[model samples]
Target: MTEAATRRVPGAPCWVSLIVHGLSATQDFYSQLFGWEFRPGPEQLGPYVRALLHGKEVAGIGQLPPDRHLPIAWTTYFATKDADVTAEAIRSCGGTVAVGPIVAGSAGRMALASDPGGAVFGVWQAAEHLGTALAGTPGTPVWNELVTRETASVAKFYQAVFGFETEAVVSADFDYQTLHLRGRPVAALHGVGHGLPRDRGPHWMTYFQVADTDEAAARVTGLGGRVLHAPRDTPSGRLATVADPEGAVFTVVRPPED
Candidate 1:
């Protein structure tokens, strides 16, 4: 099983989505790398669509709408017991509250917030279900990692909101400080004392696992997705950056053999 699969809260990371600028091409590019199939569903909010990977409901991807002016990015949803409380903790912990504390039908509730370093994530309150009906296999969401500065402060922020415990990132000795909730690793923390990509703001990036990073990267190229960064090895294993034909950027991670 994937390290991410071992991190479930009986239904954690239940859902996630990649916010993009263009819907048509974004769908085509990701279908190649992750083998995801997105189809229009009952319109709930905006152009929301159901995302499936390997024939299982995994997540969602849709245009953020032009009025929002938000860049294309991936957002993850962590199953929470209470989104209202989670939203409050986010503000108290020096994070930004972007949206929610709103109930999403019977599926559950959600609150959108950002960490101290400006990486945005969501808190999900599971009702009849918890999170992703599927995860942690090849071409599925195996991890949600954050790359930013202020590892300690970021850890503190998440701890306050999600009740996660964190050790010193420096001690993890890995590229990022891993965080745990309910005795299971939920996400990672990356410090950025170094310079940014030509100087951009700090943000969160999601990594979906695949069987072969090189082959997936090649598929991304073939599907007209932009390769932002070539495959590289980290303490976590091989990873690469890719942007959909529509310019939505996300990563692909291939963990070391178990």
Candidate 2:
């Protein structure tokens, strides 16, 4: 098996960061929900801003150049050893490379690409920075999911690119499959079915841990963000779908940790 196939995150569910169109507004929306703290990064780093939750570094947020019309949303990044090879794997698997195997100084390298199902994800080659030094508390990434109406096609798409295996996980109440890399659970994939809204697209949504679901949902609307779905309970936790001011849909989950 390929090294990439065998490679597993020693601790899965790593930190997730995103590049948004409107940095100021996105910052305000998230800070209120998670009580995030932010400050300017190195002066040479341009406009990149680092965010901390509960006094621990959680994610990075930066503004897209003025010429780009990208929507504001969270992008998921997986830890990889070689970002360039991963980009090639993305192409080889019927996925597209959307960005670069760009270097992040002594912090390792990264690249952005989309899966065959149109879900965008990132690959991080960690050096000094291993990603989300802190996670799963108030203000860090709690869970990541890929939601699609055609789960089989999406599964094949990810399996072809990431070299991970997936099995159908069906139960009396829930229908989902867990994605495994070398038999280790990396993430989950499930069908959204035709009951989903029309504007919804096959995509990966990152969830942030929070204290209260209703308060978080209300704060999203209070800050110019939209609540795509109201608070709902799953076997895992209480979750609510939301969109940043620029229209990227993500979820906020407050699950009891083990």
Candidate 3:
């Protein structure tokens, strides 16, 4: 595993978080699934804890505000130099900023926003905390992708808001575009068309690295979660889609061997 001590490049996915109704149960589910240890942090946001792998920060889980009727799903946060500017850019580009560009104590400044397709995400300006602090290891976040109804207009929205360069897959059957930062692929936008789940609107999907995809899927069920998709081999790796006990969906992937 590698230590991520510095802020990620602007527009790159810097962190992923989930807000759920059952904080203790959610933590227990992830701890058994990913071998993550918890540490209290960023207390400004109600009851929250950061997941750590071998002392390096990996992700965060927090309890949802009781009165807010929000979905229990993971949110992907993109690194930005200035949260206020990014929030404005989102508004000007036909997106909405649902939350503030408020400071999370000394951790960072953040805002929640949704794309033109209604895919929610976050813009983070790092301060003392540099988002996810480890990578290249099992149990840490490896990839983030926006799965939406269509890619063309929403892709343009992201490009305008974050200055990302996009490279689209040329295949006729695959409607996908990879978002690039400094010529390196940072994230992806997948146009699922009619395949988009009716109950779950367009959303950012976070992929956590695992050693074995099949075993991980089995473990998810054993831990009171449900496997939405069985393990399957993809061009990228073997992966499975799963939802926690409270139905926060995410993917677990075992990357193709190098």
* Cα-based lDDT for every prediction: 0.71, 0.73, 0.93
Report the lDDT tens digits of candidate 3 across residue range 108-187: 99999998888899989999988999998899999999999889888999999998999999988899999998999989
Candidate ordering by TM-score (highest first): 3, 1, 2
Tens digit per residue, CA lDDT, model 1, 1-258: 322232246224556777677777677766666777876643544676767765666777766767787766678887766777777878888988888887666666777888777777777787754556666687677777677765766776776777677755555444457787677776777776664453345666778888888888888889887788999998788999887776667788899876
Q: Give candidate 3 regions above 4 Å deviation.
A: none
Against the true structure, what is every candidate's RMSD?
Answer: 3.0, 4.8, 0.8
The segments of candidate 1 whose C-alpha lies over 4 angstroms from its true place after superposition are 1-12, 169-175
The candidate that achieves the highest TM-score relative to the unseen native structure: 3
**TM-score to native of every candidate shown:** 0.87, 0.86, 0.98
Cα misplacement distance, residue 228 of candidate 3 (Å): 0.7
Residue-level lDDT of model 2, residues 148-242, one tens digit each, is 76677778877766676888876754557888876777788867777555665666788877788878888888888889899999888899998
Clashing pairs in 3: none
* Candidate 1 positional error at 141, Å: 0.7
TM-score of 3: 0.98
Better of 2 and 3 by TM-score: 3
